[model samples]
Target: MSKISTAILRGVSGAFIANSGVGKIGMPAEYSAGVQQAAASGIPALAKLPSDKFGTWLGYAETGLGAALLAPFVPSRIAGAGLAAFGGGLLSMYFRNPENTEADGIRPSQEGMSLAKDVFMLAIGLALMTQGDDK
Candidate 1:
């Protein structure tokens, strides 16, 4: 059986991420374009895709990742890997934009506060990955 702590972490984060993904799947064109533009600023390759495609693909990715995390049959390490990758991507976006950071560069500017909070997901993912099964 999974530990209670692990279950709670997976349940909460999975639900939140999945819900966010569902919302993005049906996002309006202007909103998709705006989000795509922001992401492109961090990873230039993202700019190559049309905004609608990017949003749909991102939504599917998030939904799949959330499902993986929520599935008890799935191994924690595997789910954690996905979460870690997602968190890393979000952090990259946060770090790559000069406008997102304060003068010190490490600290988050007002615009970056939301992105900076994604670090918790990275931490949780690492924790899940390293933890042994409860037995």
Candidate 2:
């Protein structure tokens, strides 16, 4: 791999691992808090499952992508794209949450931002797919 490609892969991989890892750990608290806060508005329990369950899935997906990126034999792009799609799915629900509005304060809006990162991850994943290991 060229220097630029190496750098790109490293950077994208780093971000994928870090972002997903953080979400994987932080999501339970953040998601539960949101649901708890929004329960008063009657959002229903079922609606919150995606956000609540996202952590486990994100952790697995991120770990896979990290491994793929770091491994000599694994496919980087495929792993990156899969992880990215996972992130995008998370974001789709995040921004759509009725309780997570900008007017409410950072608590709600942060969810939107969190979801947006998923979209970004998806793009990175796509890039990885496009540019697999050169060697």
Candidate 3:
């Protein structure tokens, strides 16, 4: 790959990692809800030991993994794979929730756009995973 391409890849990877880290931490409610749901649906006895504890751990894991991906020394491909997997899980959850309609306070058009963005970002992450750090 060209020097410029590598630079662009690195910049994109860094930005994505950092931004995702912040989102994961800032949006603890989202992850917490997932954990709670998983626990309620017979996820695992250990995981459901304490709902609040599980939620906190899930939040920490999300933020920590995201930050690790942002570190300069980390391999871009691994980071991308992690983020891609996370995005896929999120996408699946969002789609699975039948109650997530505009009637639930989420504007249908905006939700569609957000879903598109998530899918696009997931594609970018998968592309990065397949392509490695450089073009």
Candidate 4:
């Protein structure tokens, strides 16, 4: 990949993860509600865990993943893989709950849309993985 493209991907994905990590830590009402929704939707275990603990774990994981993607010392593919797993988990939650989507049952509900964007992280992770090949 060209340097410009790589930089853009790194910057955008890094920022996104970083923001999510921070928000998870803060546990703002909206973010907390989203977490609860995830638990209620499919990840029932999350609902059982204390929200503070769950949010803290999520926050740290996201922060580490974001840092890895942003830092030159870390391999992008590895970081991307971690990010992909996280994003996949979120997608799974969305998939498990049709009610989270619109009437079409394809697009996410307004609240779910924020998480719907995590789909891009999966793509980004795949792209980074493919970077092992020469452009």
Ten residues in a row with the worst lDDT in model 3? 39-48
Per-candidate Cα lDDT values, in order, are 0.86, 0.57, 0.57, 0.75
Off by over 4 Å in 3: 1-35, 38-49, 100-116, 132-135
lDDT of 1 by residue, 18-119 (tens): 888877887777888888998887788988888867787788889998998999998888898889888988999999998889999999999999999999
Using TM-score, rank the candidates from best to worst: 1, 4, 3, 2
**Winner by TM-score:** 1
Show how many residue pairs clash in every candidate, following the order shown.
0, 3, 0, 0
Best by lDDT: 1
Tens digits of per-residue lDDT for model 2, 1-135 = 464775576566666585655566545757645644443233344355565654565566566656666665556656656656655655546555754558653344654564445556667666766774656
**TM-scores of the models, in the order given:** 0.92, 0.52, 0.58, 0.78
Clashes of 2: 3
Residue 99 error for model 3, in Å?
Answer: 3.9
Report lDDT (Cα) of residue 75, candidate 2: 61
Q: Cα miss at 17, model 4 (Å)?
A: 1.1
